[model samples]
Each structure stands twice: as structure tokens, then as C-alpha cells.
Target: MHELIVSPYMGRFVMVKPGRKEGGTMPAYLYRELAETAPTSPCPDWLVKAARQAWHTELEGRPLAPAVLVRDDPGLGYGRASWELNLGCNYDCEHCYLGIKDFAGLELPERVRVLHTLRDAGVLWLQLTGGEPMVDRLFTETYAAAYDLGMMLTVLSNGSRLFLPKVLDLLTERRPDRVTLSVYGATEESYDGLTRRKGAYRLFKKGLDAGHEAGLPLSLSMIVTRHNAHEVPMMRHIAERIGAPMEEYTNMVPTIYGGDETLPTQSAEHLRRRKPFTGCNAGHTFFHVNPFGRASICKVGRDPAVDLLAEGVEGLSRLGAIADSLLLRQGGCTGCGLQGTCGTCMPLVQLYRKAEAPLATYCQHREKEESV
Candidate 1:
């Protein structure tokens, strides 16, 4: 495995280290020149200069072998992707968007195939997520495969299994770009109550401390639900104590399957107003995949997904059009006068409508246009 990756990301050239802790942009011409350099040739002076400036590494006279320099293919224009390894989780939180958590996923053979497919699809940045990714039986294998294939990996977990020797060792050996753990609460009582799992908080704290001690790049998602809304201050304190950046999430939406069971968990006081819906490069520059290899424009707009395993990379040809159609303001949003100021995107609005959720939760129409 190379210590550095020189690759094309959505039309831009980037020089990134393995774990992605440090990186910066490089000239396109230089990237091409390096790509054409002989493997056994001396490491180019430009690389040394860039590495020194960007990563502060001293590669004075190293050989230009695959271990020192890995070049990534700019495949199919897709640069990033997220995959749900499985829907299984140890802690079932009240605010979880996955309605039904099942302990099932593709076997090892199929999982490896999916990872290769992701690599071939030009995914340099890949997020391995799940109901709780660590709970999947083949989680470590899948992670290792992706990392070895030169993708900068990110793991989204609940911090419940990071303390285990196997999990910690694997992470320490092959560090991910980031380990994003969702913090449910600052106290055991509040955390356990919110997750509906007794003693869940203890395990989470242990795992968090271990991960930090192992020098892993970690971040915290401060999940604010009605059950733990009072602990926001303490959550911030915990994040600061661990020296990891924290982001608060207050807008609780319906489950991915359009179930309204999670709506009650929203923290009314902490619900922040979303920014105006500009636009996203979801299907054009990136995509998402489920545990079963179904690829979609993004996690929110999962319909019209392509069976990646069956159709292969060519199937992704349909996602850009799918995204375009989904983004069109239709159904409940059609001809809405508030389209200019609405913050929610059409796909998410479709989900809210499917759940028959209160308009106040997702729309400005009820509050502004109708009332006026």
C-alpha cells in the first residue's frame, strides 16, 4: 500500500495521504507526468517538494515504487460513495432512520465483489455505514478490502464496539480517514433510555476512550432528541474533553422506509432551520449503495436504484437522470409559490409526504402561504 495517493477527484487533482489526515491539490500536468513515470525510477523532486509542503514528510531519495506512490484511475466521473454494510445494530436509538434493523448482509464473496465494484466505479472516498457497521460479521474484512484497494475510508458507527481488541487492532493497523461516532447522550441514563438498550452508554464511553487513545481520527455527531435534549451542554463538554470535533443534529426525519415512528423524537427547541436548497452533485459526482448492492443517487432518494451486482458499473449511467427527475418539484411541491424560499429538497419532501407527517415538520407552505 502506498503512503500517498495521487488521484483525480471530480475533475480536480488531489494528493492525499493514506489516512487522509493531510492532503492538498496538485497541478494537473504534474499528476499526469507522475502517472507516466516508471515504477522503479527515483521519486520525482516535485513529489518530494509537494510532500514536504503538504504533509511535512521528508522523502529525500525514495524509490518511486507502488508502496511509495499509488496512482488512482479517474473512473466514470464518480469520486465518492457510501455503502451500508448491514442494517444490524447493537443499540436501537429512538431517532434512528433505519426503521427495521435486521442482522443480515451479503456473505464474504458477495461483499468483496461489491467492494471491487466500488473501486472500479472511481470511488476514491468511500463511507462504510450501517445501522451500526461494526456489528456486521464481515465488517473488518470489507473495510480492509476497501482500504487495500486504495480508497480513503470513513466509518460511521455508534462507538459501541471500538473497545474490542479485534476492532481496535484493525483500526489501528489501517486507520480510516475518519471514524464518525454518534453520541446519543452525555449520561448513562439518558443515553440508555434514548437507545432503548440498558448499559449501552458504558460501552460507548469505553469504546470512545479507547479509540482516542489509539490515535485514531475521530469525530462526534451530537444527536439531539427530546430524550436527551437537556444534555447538549454536557455533550459538548465530552467532545472537547476527547479533543474531537462535534456536530449537532436536531432535525429528526421519518425513517428511510417512510415510517413516522421516529418523528416524536425530534427536539423542538433544538430544531435548527435548514439552509435554502441550492443544488447537489449527488448522482453526477457521487452515489450511494445499500447492503444488497443497490446503487442510488443518494441515501435520501433511494427509489429507481440500479442493481449494481447485476448491471455492474454501466448501470450507474441511469443515476444522473434519476437524480434530475427526483429533484423536479412535483406532487405536493408542484407549482408551490414558496419554491424560492423552501429549505427542504424535493426527495426529502416526498419522504415526509409518504409518512403523512405534519406539514410544520418539513414545509413552509403551511406556516406562510396557507396562513397568509
Candidate 2:
């Protein structure tokens, strides 16, 4: 009988037909490995590739493109979580939302406590993001802790630290479900130039090479700002060389504290705003926990957070209520002439405007949409 395997890491379903060469039987462990790595047994190279392509196509058609699951759980009753392991990072990018400063996050014991809390809350998948999670003092132990909990892990990093022997060993032993490396530049000139750190590009390249060799599932992303926009093509070429797909993002909102808007991009029209603003999974089946243990609907989303350390799963229960409250406060965008055209949502309105009023700067979309 043929078996259909769901790869949570790769987000694809592969059709496996046991080959007749080995007594017409393939072991179950082989299926698991195949699901994770796309091994050359029980399937040809072409079929494996085709299956992956089909899966990505399916994902793009869905409302939440990155969430790959066999079934859709609306409540996300037991779902995915994003952890900002720490606010400390190794590199300082000019357009960074956090403004490129280092600070201590939770202590190691507290971090472990947070992991236990998430696993208990039925959070099976975790995305460990950061100011650069690698720089966190407790990163390795916390990663091991998550792996021990049988939770699928995805790490977002600048890739500079993966070259260390200890880091590589941890990744090789307890392989994360996926690793996404943020590519700063195709060359050292633009990379170190943008980050203002000498030899940053070299370290990033070394990390990528090490990660590729360790067989880690990798992807590349470039935050397209004015300075590095010209190097985007070169970055894509680097992604191809690393055998990882490239994702480019241009819609950079101001920092959570409304710090700066100096980064240039395509246009306000390209922002990720949909009518009625209902596509987000934040505070429902998904939530973001920042360095200080503040849990919100999303990473960029601030205000109305429940302290995960103090509240635990019980606090998480209030997120739905918090979300309901945010949704209720839709403000002027509720029935504006540019409702469908503007990207303003409650969290964004909170970010840029005064407590009682919407910001006219954010309303620039109305004029643009009307003039068109």
C-alpha cells in the first residue's frame, strides 16, 4: 500500500510507494527520514521535487501562507508560538525596528520556565527569533530544552554564530525543524557597510556554509531597505547557491515604540493591508513573546500584553479577550472610503497615533487611493 506522509518541517505531503528491491518492504523510520530530508529511496528525485513545489503552491493559496498543517485549527487551541529569545543581537542594522541595541532578556532559568509553560499550553511549534537569538546566553540550553519537549523548532538568525563548534554540534544533534538566515548583502561591501560592523559579512557567509554542510533546512530572507535594495539580485544569487528559497519583504513599519521611519521602500500601496483586517492569526492560535516575557498578538504588536511568566497558560487564555478588544477598536478605518485600500489596523493605529485619534501620516493611503 502507498503511504502519504506529511512533512511539518517542509510543509509538504509526499506520496511514498515502497520499493520492491528490499523484500518489498521499507522500514517506518525511513519514512520519517524521508519526510524530513526527502531521501532518494522509495521516490525519485523528480517526484520529490515536484511534491515540494506543489506544497508551496498550496500554501500561497491559503489565508495564512506560512502555517503548514494537515488541518486548520481556528482557535489554534494548541498552536504555534514566536519567542523573542532576547533583545540582544550581534549585528546592528540601520533600519532595525529595535534600533540596534543590546540588552539582557530573561534569565536562563526563566527562559527554561517559559519553554515548559509553552509546551504545557499545547504549543507544539515554536519560532525562536530575537535581536539575534544566537547571542542569547541561554540559546543552546533553551534550544535543547525545546527539542526535549518534542516541539518543532524554527530559528530566525543572522547566521554569524552557527559556525561555532558548540552551536553546530547542538544544531546537528537536535536539528531544528527549519532555519531561516537573514541575508544582509551579497558582498562584504554592502553587508558590513549597512551593518556598520567590520567582517560581519564574512562571519555570515561562514555560518551559512556551516549550516549547509550540517544538513539544516535553510531559507533566506532580505529586508529590502533603501541602502541594500540594489544588492537584492546578488542576495538572490547567494540564496540559489545555498539551495534555499528567498523571501523579500519591504513593508517596514516604525518600531514598536514608534522610533523611526527612515527606511525607504517601494510604496505605501505595497503594504500588507487587507480590507476588514481579518487575516492575522495573532492572539488566537498564534502569539509573540518578547524578551521581558510580554506576550502579544504579534512581534510588532505592542500594548495589552499578558505577562507569560506571571500569568502562565491562564494568562494566555485572556489573549482572545485582548484580541477581541483590539478588533473592537477599529477607529476611523472602520467604514472609511479607503477601508479596503488602507493598511491601518488597531495595532498600527496604536503604534502611530495618539491614544484618542488616528495619525494623519498613516492616512496618506486615503489620498493616494482616492487620487487613483
Candidate 3:
């Protein structure tokens, strides 16, 4: 049985395995030193209480509960979890990440079990995403379950189904921690053109209007592509008019299966000029569980994953090893000159590469950056 040590305020959790033997009766001064070395954050009251409990128990010539002591330790650093509920979508966007595959995801009961496992594993924030999470039949069931377990839930949707009475009612009743709407284009011609669907812009607005009427806090995101990049300003204005903040993302990588080439990527200089966010926060503090109950550090990390339904908590130990193996020091990416500017890392290289070395697409970016 694994134990979860939770800091309620900071929403950080450490998972402890059986017979770890890291914590026991120790000097008070040593414990203080260990606490000081832990991640720099405002220590929560739950941590303070756990520490006091540990000290009192230790004074009595016994070891404190592992959960109490694990607070000051950094063995486990899981905080946020993302679920790709299903890979089915109504509107077919050209630059879809999962491509146009229609995958039959985990059934309701299995999804419920996975959610329980995640909560028990000390996940604090749960983000439900997908081709459009709201479009899934089990969306409400899973959302309700997460809400019942007190997990902070966020829903990512295209805003097409939001105008439905049932959809509006469910959101009104549960009121997720946050709701994000992906706006393809500001106008119908551009939006429908990108989505390749007629009457999409009207439906999207209907969803946004419904979200606002339900009093749900909505955030807007636009996938910046050559097809719709010019509409960014107009999209921002629409977001502002609707009283929701907007963000633009231009980093369009290849699909998981490497099929879609419809959306053109940003220039190497443009990608390099932005802040360096090379390694993803996969198994470290973030996780992505696809609809098939396959869990990985991030969405694009499909090749290396653990089937949560088959293994349960015992399988999560792989995540820590995954995090370690993905470190920059563990691979050739360590001394590379294009460290910050280049986005290719071991995990991504593993995802897109066809041979032992990185693909030309990644090297091209690095080469371009070098020449400049």
C-alpha cells in the first residue's frame, strides 16, 4: 500500500512506497535542516501540523507516521493531473493533435476507478481535456466523481456543445474550477474555414454565451497557425468583449502519429525567440492520462506509458524513473549549444525520430538557430 503525504495549502503531494525507510526517529536539528532544503514554497498549515505530530511522536521513542515526515522530504512531487477523456471530436480541425482517430475510451466504471486512483495518489488539480471532453458520454460522470472527491477540476472544450440545455445545466450545477474554450477564428468565414465545418462560428459563440450565462469563469485559447494567425487580434478582442482572458499558442509540432501537415509551424527564429520551455513537466509535477487509461508524463509521450487500469498504484513508480531518464544531463542534449532555443529533447526526439538520431525537422531548427 502506498501512502500520500499532502500539503493542503500549497497543493503538493509526496507518494511514499512501502518499506522506503527514509524517515524515522532522527535529531530535531536534522529534521529542521531537511525541511529547509525542501522546495522553496510557503509551508502550509497542514505541513506545520504534520511536523508537530512527527516531533511529538519522535520524542516518545517511536517513528512518526511516514505521511507526517514525508512533508519535509521530496521523494514524490505530483501536484497536477490531466486526462484526455476521449479522442473523438465533432469538428475536424486540420491541426488536431490526436489526428482524426475515433478511439473508444475507457468505460464509465473504469474511468471512475482511474479517478479514484489519481486522487489517492495525491493529485490536487485535475484537468479534463480531449478532442472535446464535453462531447464524451462519460464526461458528466467523471466530472461529477472528481468533483465529489474534492479534486479541483478544469474542462477544456471547443465550446460547440456548451449551448445545449443539459450541458449548461451540468456546468451550472458542478461549476468546475475553471473552463477553457478554444476559439479557432474570430469570424465565421475564417473559423469555419479552419474547422472545415459550416456554421461552426455561430455554435462556438453560443457555447461561449452559455458559459458566461452560467457564470462560469472562462479562458480563451487560439491555436496560431498560418491559416488563422491573422485573426489573433480579432480573437483577443472577442475574448475581451466576453470578459475572458485570451492566450495565443504558435508552437505547433507534428501530430502524435506524425500525419497532419495542414497547419504550418512558426519559424525557427520565432520559436527560439520565445522563452525556453524545453523539457515537459511530464512525470514530475504533471501527468497526462489518455482515454485508453494509458498514463504518461505528457500527451505526446505515448510510446512510453503505463496502463493504469492494468497495474494501478504499483505502476506509478515508473513515473519517477521516467522523470529521471528525461533529465537533460542523462542525454546528448546536455551540452548542446541550442539548449534554450531548440525545443527537441530526448522525449520529443523519441516521439518523432525514425532512427537512432533526431529527425531533420528538429535539426533544421537547431541549424537555423546556429546560423543566426
Q: List the residue pairs that clash in candidate 2.
A: none
- Model 1 scores what on Cα lDDT? 0.87
Candidate 3: residue 307 Cα off by (Å)? 1.4
Specify the poorest-scoring 10-residue window by lDDT in model 2: 16-25
Off by over 4 Å in 2: 1-76, 261-276, 354-372
Taking all chains together, each candidate's TM-score versus the true structure is: 0.96, 0.74, 0.74
Q: Which lDDT tens digits does candidate 2 get at residues 298-349?
A: 7766668989889987888888778767754465556656555455576776
lDDT of each: 0.87, 0.67, 0.67
Q: State the lDDT at 106 in candidate 2.
A: 85
Most TM-score-accurate candidate = 1
lDDT tens per residue, model 1, 1-372:
567777778778888886657788878888888888888777889888888888777666877776455556645898999999999898878788889998887888888888788777788899999989998989999998888887899999998999999999998888899999999999999999999999999999999999999999999999999999999999999999988999889999888989999999998999888877877888988999998999999999999899988988888889999999988899868898878878988889988988999998888866785677
- Per model, state how many residue pairs clash: 0, 0, 1
User: Which runs in model 3 stand beyond 4 Å of their true positions?
Assistant: 1-76, 260-274, 277-280, 327-335, 352-372
Q: What is the TM-score of candidate 3?
A: 0.74
